[model samples]
Target: MSETESRPAPSQLRRLPWSEDGKSAYLSTGDGASFLARMADTMEEGMLTTAEVDMTRALSVADEVSASRAELKMAVRFLAHAVADAVEVARLRGERLGVDPEAKETAEFLRRTLTR
Candidate 1:
């Protein structure tokens, strides 16, 4: 069977249990909060690394117009992914702190837009 056929559908995946108001009500315990903070730091570092790589690639290809164009395209793709990762980190932090639900929703919307 093809890879697509072998995998379960999106709907078949286990979903996280959200609060009744469609918000994450579970406040992170001490350990959970620490874990979330560490993850956020890791994600931020990764995004910074991606940005640095994109800049290096762009600079290296500056003399070649065609190559520069390709590098710019790749940079945009990497930046988009980085933005999404940042958003996820923000979402996790917000969930841990029990921030406003709308803020989380807005972050998720921006992440989806970047992915598309």
Candidate 2:
């Protein structure tokens, strides 16, 4: 379950996949070790990988001086999607970096929650 970015407490929110309605989704994690957190990490990695491929293909097409208008249009579309994916990856990494990995409170909280 993800709370929208419009909510408060940015440091605690990990960006998740978009909702069915297309709104951005976020997860509140305890020590960032839960199944959901791992899933989010995997998703973020996938997004970046796919974005890299998309950007590479788009650049290749754009570099071709003789690219047809239709080809250029497709490249633009791909580039736009790649940029959007990168933005989301940045947001997720930013939020994660803001968290202090050495924070005892988070570790203790996760330990308690997991054992219950």
Candidate 3:
């Protein structure tokens, strides 16, 4: 007997579940999602590291010279804003790809930096 004749038709495959809100959420009952989540976490970590490095460099520069207090504060504020922007972009990218980004790590880094 031919393979097609021996097996069930394409329509026999079960339909995937859909969310009530109509968001096309993927059922990650598979290994792919776990891998992707790790990838997203790694990516976000890298971006966060880069942002921290940039901020640290600016902070160092501010500490070096006799910059006015206002100028130093402005520079630090700008660096913080840039870090926030990077975090949002990273998180959005991960979410769109059905992955969970390293939100806690990034937030902790930002918090510690700001506190110091």
**Which runs in model 2 stand beyond 4 Å of their true positions?**
1-10, 20-23, 99-116
Itemize residue pairs with steric clashes in candidate 2: none
**Alpha carbon lDDT at 77, candidate 3:** 82
Question: Which of candidates 2 and 3 reaches a greater TM-score?
Answer: 2
Mark the regions of model 3 whose C-alpha exceeds 4 Å error after superposition: 1-33, 66-82, 85-116
Candidate with more favorable, higher lDDT: 2 or 3: 2
Per-residue accuracy of model 2 over 1-116 as CA lDDT, tens digit each? 46664455766776676664687777766454899878877888899899999999999999999999999999999989999999878866856777566665787699899999
Candidate 3 overall lDDT versus native: 0.60
Return the number of clashes found in candidate 3. 0
Residue by residue across 66-115, what tens digits does model 1's lDDT show? Answer: 66566777766766665665555455444446657797789779989999
Q: For candidate 3, write residues 5-116 as lDDT tens digits.
A: 8655533322222234775323232334466456555655676677777787678768878887877877788698667858665545544454334766787799999999
In terms of lDDT, model 2 sits at: 0.80
Residue 69 local lDDT, model 1: 61
Worst 10 residues of 3 by lDDT: 10-19
Candidate numbers sorted by lDDT from highest down: 2, 3, 1
